[model samples]
Target: MSAAHVPVLLAEVVDALQPRAGETIVDGTFGAGGYSRALLAAGSSIIAFDRDPGAAQFAQGLPADRFRLLERRFSELDAVTGPGAVDGVVLDIGVSSMQLDQAERGFSFMRDGPLDMRMAADGPTAADLVNAAEPAEIARILYVYGEERESRRIARAIARRREEQPFTRTLELAEFIEKTLGGRRGAKVHPATRSFQAIRIAVNEELAELEAGLVAAESALKVGGRLCVVTFHSLEDRIVKTFLAVRAGKTPGGSRHAPPVETTAAPSFQLSFNGARTASAAELAANPRARSAKLRAAVRADAPVWRAAA
Candidate 1:
């Protein structure tokens, strides 16, 4: 198995996949290849995907034939595998430990590093957004992605500060944000948490990627194949929850806020397990990061893939 960081909910994710020998499985986020390694050990062949070019180093030593790592984003899974060709698909959403632990990656506010949060090596960095985006747009991103109620206040501070000196390093922005919030109080979380999350999400466009990847996974899995997703934050969990709920034809009937819901097609998937599952206390103790992790799994129905709703 490759040396990707230890996967969160390893046993539970594998159990949901129920991979067997000779089956081909998709590990949509191959950060450190923990899930791919577990799937490999389960007697399944794996086609792993990761957008970060740096992640390719972890693919070394994995079996050449049984394991293949694509430097492509998980959103491209359908293009790689073709329709209904794989046995199962699994996605571990959001940033990985390898990225977070590296100060150079700028994924965490706890440590200082470059303000480059691009999961892939290229494109606009977090520095680019904070240094260039309009204050209102920045405020909107923080409000929508990070759920920060004080987004405008924070954005105004950022806009003012960047005028004197543009943010170039991760800690520079983090400390500035904390100070703008009047310093940390008794709260266990850092004051910069929400802004960092918001900036990172904008830099990477992660939410859109997640939505596209979910649709791609649906297109790639075979009949009776499984789809498993693990998400850390509420935004990601909401997407997974709603996608599964909608695909399973379990969306609640319409209310006054909306028109009557339409069920124009057969269900695309059946729940492999009941609702979302959380980590056990034992697992949480072993890895504090597992505290917020949520797992959702489903099996593909024989019905044809439905067009993405508008």
Candidate 2:
């Protein structure tokens, strides 16, 4: 494992999936192949997916007979694997450590690089978003995605500045955001952190992709197959939590004050355990990034995959 890209909750995720010989597992986010490599060690065949072209560099040296890497998004997993094909699916949501460490990737504000934050090789970059989006849209992106409190103020400042010069560099925007927010006021985190996160999420459509990927996992896993997800923030966690809760038949019944959520389809998944698992104290001591990480796992039920009504 790369010291810089330590897989979060590896032991817990491996325990949840319990890979066995001849079983096929899908590594939904093969950033540095940490999960895939661990699962492969357990004697399972690995089918890993990553949209980032740079991720292919890490796939080298792995046994070609046991491991296969796909240069595609995990949301397309079911389309590639077909229904109920895999034994397990594991997703590590949000940007990868490798992406952050590469200055040219433009995922970290601390790094001075071009303002391109696309996870894949192509797309409208984060620079395009901030420089061209309307002030209201930019504020909405910051407030909704980043949960930044001073989103409107920041958006206004960005609007005023972009009129004179477009943001092309990561540090240029980071420093501007810091100055606009009055030099962080002794805050532990930088003022640009939230804004950068919001912009990246917006540029990548991360939340939507997560929702679609979860549904894809449901379709891809066989009965009794495992699905494990590691989410870094509340936005991602909430989606996974709700998806499992509803799919596990844990939704609330009708009440006098509120109507019941329509239960039209059979539950397709069962929670592996109640609630999510956090990293152990030892794990947290080694990796501060694990502080915000939450691991949720479930087992596929012997039922049909749920489809939303048109």
Candidate 1 wrong stretches, greater than 4 Å: 1-4, 253-261, 308-310
Candidate 2 clashes: the total is 0
The Cα error of candidate 1 at residue 257, in Å, is 12
Top candidate when judged by lDDT against the true structure: 2
With candidate 2 superimposed using the best TM-score fit, by how many Å does residue 164's alpha carbon deviate from the native? 0.4
* Weakest 10 consecutive residues of candidate 1 by summed lDDT: 252-261
| Candidate 1 local lDDT, 280-305, one digit each (tens) | 89888878899999999999998888
Q: What is each predicted model's overall lDDT from 0 to 1? A: 0.89, 0.93
lDDT of 1 at 139: 97
